[model samples]
Target: MDLTVTDLACARGGVTVLERVNFRLAAGAALILRGPNGIGKTTLLRTVAGLQPAVAGDVSMAPESVAYAAHADGLKATLTVAENLAFWAAIYGTDEVSRAMERMNLAALADRQAQNLSAGQKRRLGLARLLVTGRPLWVLDEPTVSLDVASVALFGTVVREHLASGGSALMATHIDLGLAEAEVLDLTPCRARSPASAGPGTDDDPFAGVTA
Candidate 1:
């Protein structure tokens, strides 16, 4: 699916954080959102994912066609790794847990309870749910939070495969995931500027209205 954002604005706690956010991502591509902490990268991803109403403008995509993975793992501690993925797959009306397990290298840990896994293992399991959702457009917020080097490589491979198969992704990350071709959007300029420096409604983010 082609995802488009038009004159987008976002807020957290009723305070606008970003404005004039615009971008378009076609199938088989990826876009990386970069910025310092608390600059509304997560807020922008949430808006695109439709978790909340956009403060202004439009995000054009069917909410059902988007799969979002937020900062937290969102795993059930008592459930086994496979069980967690299975639960999400069922919710997405899919049953392809086996391949997702293999992709995330969770085959051996399938029966292990989520609570028993280490942090990195838990992160992989959390990301495994993305594959199970089978959605065309993935909106991921810091998808690689606790992953090790090799595991991060694995994530890059998975994302590359997703793009190769005509899927698209929007991700916010502090560290490099080694996605070379993805367009980078620095959100620094998009942050709300101080009233003293700029008038009201100026995009506060430093990267506002810009893409690279």
Candidate 2:
């Protein structure tokens, strides 16, 4: 398995956000995690990315094998775009940061402060960070938010290319990404106490009792 999550559980403030979620993904594949608001989509992605302290589960992954792009930029406002790219590249020991920036259409913004860029620009820069990394697994949360239609189309292209390049992706997106042939993994019923008991506005969670 390129990625696997067995008996995973997540919590936030004593609320069960996810429970008993399990899956396996392979290289050169893509999977979409779909749900409505507050259904633990973001939480689940964080868990997969190892950013969130999982409540209970064995999430086996390749070390330094994943790159995550969240809804927030996570950019240093005081730093210029090139500075940001250089900083991340140096941190990751990569020398081809400029090429990644150019691929993300942020080369022109290289001298601009991250704070000064528009939301779309910031998101692009954030994505650039992932591109420059050599990680094999990608965990994206609402990647196309605040982007124009053109940018959204561009994102679909990027994702398709990434899949074609033998990379794997797990994404949580409310909007249709228009990927040519990606599979959808609906976790709604799997995360709930039971399918029959699950209803609208009811999202099943396993760590509902844990704090944070």
Candidate 3:
């Protein structure tokens, strides 16, 4: 399951955040996106997820082949970790949800409600949803934000397994989780020129109303 982004461009509030981004990621590899704030790292992830409008390019990916984890955990406050994973598993048709939870070090908190868990715990659970999707391409935004060192290691292990099994990941993170042989697609170079204002189409734009 390889990912190809050709002439990919995204606009937020009539401003182009990224453009001419051509890259292809093969299965069993990872690409890390690095850049400072307001540079569209998260926006890139959203574009891959088909959440934002690709103003002038093509993001061609099978709907069911892409999985995305955002900065905001999608966990239900009243739901237990097991319940949340179970729900996603049913949707994705993955009975391996328990296995994913175990790999993420979430088995211990499986029965505990998400609201009672620490920030790091919730983040881990939120990330574990990726496994449930059974998708080959993973797009993550600030995945390591609230993770502890131990949990971070667990996450790395999960990612390694994903790659080993012919899965690919595109991650937006400021911290180093020691992903093996990851390629960096720095957005810094593309930022030398400011984004021009543009109209939004049917792509992923979280800041549709925010001015550039």
Candidate 4:
């Protein structure tokens, strides 16, 4: 599945954060977004994931073809590693928990409660959900958070395998994970130039304020 974003715009609190964002990710490839904090990297990812609407332009991709993983590991602390994967697999209508665990090197901790796992372990578990999603496109926000060096390497390998299998990914991260080949998009240039003091829709504003 390929992703195409044309003249896209993103906003927070009705204020445009990034504008004219555009990119195309072919299948079996990855696009890494790089920028400073609060630069709308996550916002763009969310818009592409269909979790939120694009403030303008177009995001061309089937919603169901995307699997999104946010910064927070949305895991059930009480559930075991295997159990957590199992739940997501059920929702995704796939029985690939065992393979997902193996792919992320979580087989050894399958029975451990999610809450007991260290930060790195938990992050891996969160990533494992992508495997069971059966979706071709992954939109990840800071997927490397809490991951150790080795775990980051493991994640790169997993991503490579996914691409080899005709999948794609869009990731926002500050560190390089040694991907085989990935296009890097710097969001700094995409930052909206309007000053904060300007009210929405006041002038060339996408979120211009309403008036009588």
Candidate 5:
């Protein structure tokens, strides 16, 4: 499935932060969102993922086809690594738990509880949930936050494999991950105007005192 966004306007804290956002991510492709911090990148991803409503415009895709991963790991602290994967596998109706563990290099720590794992290990486990989701589009925000150099490279390989299998990814990140084929979409131009200085209804101030 392909992901498409046209003339999207999104808000954070009831204030618009991004507008005129447009993009199309076809199957087997990846699109990287680049912009400085607090530039509405997270807000855009959340809106696209359907976590929140768009202030205006359209996001074209089946909601079930998307798998969203945000800054939070969304892990079960008491569950073991393998168990966590198994839980997610059950939710997505996939039996790829073992495959996900091996792919994220978590097989060695399968029996360890999520809370007992190191930060990077936990991050890997959190990311492994994407594999079990069985969804075509991956919407990720800062996926490599806690990953080390080697782990980042490993994740890059996993992303490539996913694309090779006709999956699509829309991510917001500063790290390279070495995705040479991924197209870049800078959100600078899409920054919403502020509310203070404007005409009757035009919010032209980009800095609206809200975090993206």
Candidate 6:
């Protein structure tokens, strides 16, 4: 599936942080979001993933087509690695649990509980969830956090495979994942004017666009 965002606006803490954002991610492609810290990359991703509403504009895609992985690992600490993937597989109605584990290099750790894994292992497990999601679009935020160089390279390979199979990805990361074909969208040009800088007649509505 393809993702098309047009004239998008995103907010953080009830304030508009990005506006006029536009991008088109075709099937079998990837888009990398780049900007300084706290520049609304996460907010934009959340909006695209349907975790939060956009302040304005539209994201065109099929419903339930997106698989989002945020900063949080979103794991069940007591669940074994295999069990965690199984849980998500059930949610997405997919039967790719074992394949997911192998893709993330967690096959050997399948019986290990999430809490017992190292930070990088936990990250791998979290990313492995995307494989079982059976969704065409992946929206990831700092997906390589806590991952070593080898793990990062592994993830890059996984993403490439995803794209090869006609999947699309949108991610925000500082480290290069070596995806030379991926397009980059820098959010700096899309940054919204702060409320303090707004012209007269603009309302200072602190509650506007507040995301839960």
TM-score-superior candidate, 4 or 5: 5
Candidate 2 wrong stretches, greater than 4 Å: 194-212
Q: What is the TM-score of each candidate against the true structure?
A: 0.92, 0.86, 0.87, 0.89, 0.92, 0.91
* Model 2 steric clash total: 5
Task: For residue 92, give model 1's deviation from the true position in Å.
Answer: 0.6
Top candidate on TM-score is 1
For residues 130-157, write the lDDT of model 2, one tens digit per residue.
8777777889998988888877877777
- What digit string (tens of lDDT, one per residue) describes model 5 on residues 63-107? 699899888999999999999999999988999999999999999
Could you give candidate 6's per-residue lDDT for residues 146-191 as a string of tens digits? 9999999999999999999999999999888888998888788677
User: Each prediction's Cα RMSD?
Assistant: 2.6, 5.4, 6.6, 5.5, 4.1, 5.1
Q: Rate the local accuracy (lDDT) of all candidates.
A: 0.88, 0.79, 0.80, 0.86, 0.88, 0.89
The number of clashing residue pairs in each candidate reads: 16, 5, 7, 4, 4, 0
Cα distance off (Å), candidate 2, residue 8? 1.4
Question: TM-score of the candidate numbered 3?
Answer: 0.87
Q: Which of the predicted structures, 3 or 4, would earn the higher TM-score when compared with the native?
A: 4
Candidate 4 structure lDDT: 0.86
Residue 21, candidate 5: how far off, in angstroms? 0.5
Give the lDDT of residue 179 in candidate 5.
80
Model 6: how far residue 58 lies from native, Å: 0.8
User: Taking the tens digit of each residue's C-alpha lDDT, what string does model 1 give over 104-163?
Assistant: 999999999999999999999989999999899989998988899999999999999999
Q: In candidate 4, what are the lDDT values of residues 1-212, reduced to their tens digit?
A: 77888878899878889887778899988889887889888888888988888889888877699999988888999999999999999999999999999989999999999999999999999999999999999999989899989899999889889999999989988778778588888877677767665466545644331110
